[model samples]
Target: MRRLLILFAAAVAAPVLAADPAPEIRRAPVPPQALGVAHTLRTIPEACARLQGEFSGDAAAPYRFAVVRTSPGCRPRARLVDAAQARPSPASGWILNDLIRVPSAACATQQAVVRVWRQPAQVAPPALDPQGRARVYLEDSLQQARAGRLAPLPAYAVSLQVEGLPCPR
Candidate 1:
């Protein structure tokens, strides 16, 4: 009697305690089909401030990066990359060597295109303010990548090729 009640309560509480907590994701999501190539050349301080604004109060949030074509005339497409794949650009203060794959409906093959985006100025992320925070976020990203937990920040990875997801109205 009492033993059965205790067992039931323990069973109910076990899952609640063992389950992983929900990730803190941001609300302002980038448009799935972003309009154009990102040509903004911002200095580090400016970039840090914008990045802070982009992630709101949480500076550790994963940012939404896009690899759009430099030229216009085609339907704009943007694909999100995980922190694991976003290699820091040595030439510029940005992510580079990111592999962007354009999904081909009829085939399963993937091709890698190499491209680097260079901003016009030498402005760096702020030294002690948001810059420090950005550095911390990137470092955390590196740690998370090692642990295979990289995609939970900005939003769970979205695949345009998923069969059952409904189209946005």
Candidate 2:
């Protein structure tokens, strides 16, 4: 009886301890569809700050990134990119590339368009303020291209842009 009870408790606790912790939500990526933009999308400090405020006190808590298109006559669309994919260089703090699909439907089999966005100015905020507030600033630029031209897409790699913050808190 003792052995069986110990085995059951061990089994129950194993999964709980072994599970991977949720990722820290340092940056949010909003699709252009929501903001109505076909060309330009800027992830400025003010917008990101406002979006982060909605989350709980925990900075690690995951929250969706809110984005808005600044171009005229452009409809809002969503562009999602993970922080891990962002590449950093001396010239730029973080860089992201996105493949813009030609069709809105998931089932549509059409040639995909590629777009690249990068923050020219990447700067980290000063000291952690009294309210535990930290700031990260980034600028976005978009250009169109194609994926089928360069290299075959990776199996696990789907259509996602790059997102990053150099000095992530």
Q: For each of the candidates, give the backbone clash count.
A: 3, 14
Question: What tens-digit string does per-residue lDDT give for candidate 2 at 22-126?
Answer: 322223543323212233323333112111111121234312234343445543233333334744222443333332322212111111222333333323335
Residues 110-167 of candidate 1 have per-residue lDDT tens digits of: 1111222222333345336545554446787689699996442221121111111111
**lDDT of candidates 1 onward, in order:** 0.30, 0.30
lDDT of 1: 0.30
lDDT of 2 at 143: 20
The TM-score values for the models, in the order shown, are 0.18, 0.19
Query: Each candidate: RMSD to true structure?
Result: 19.7, 19.5
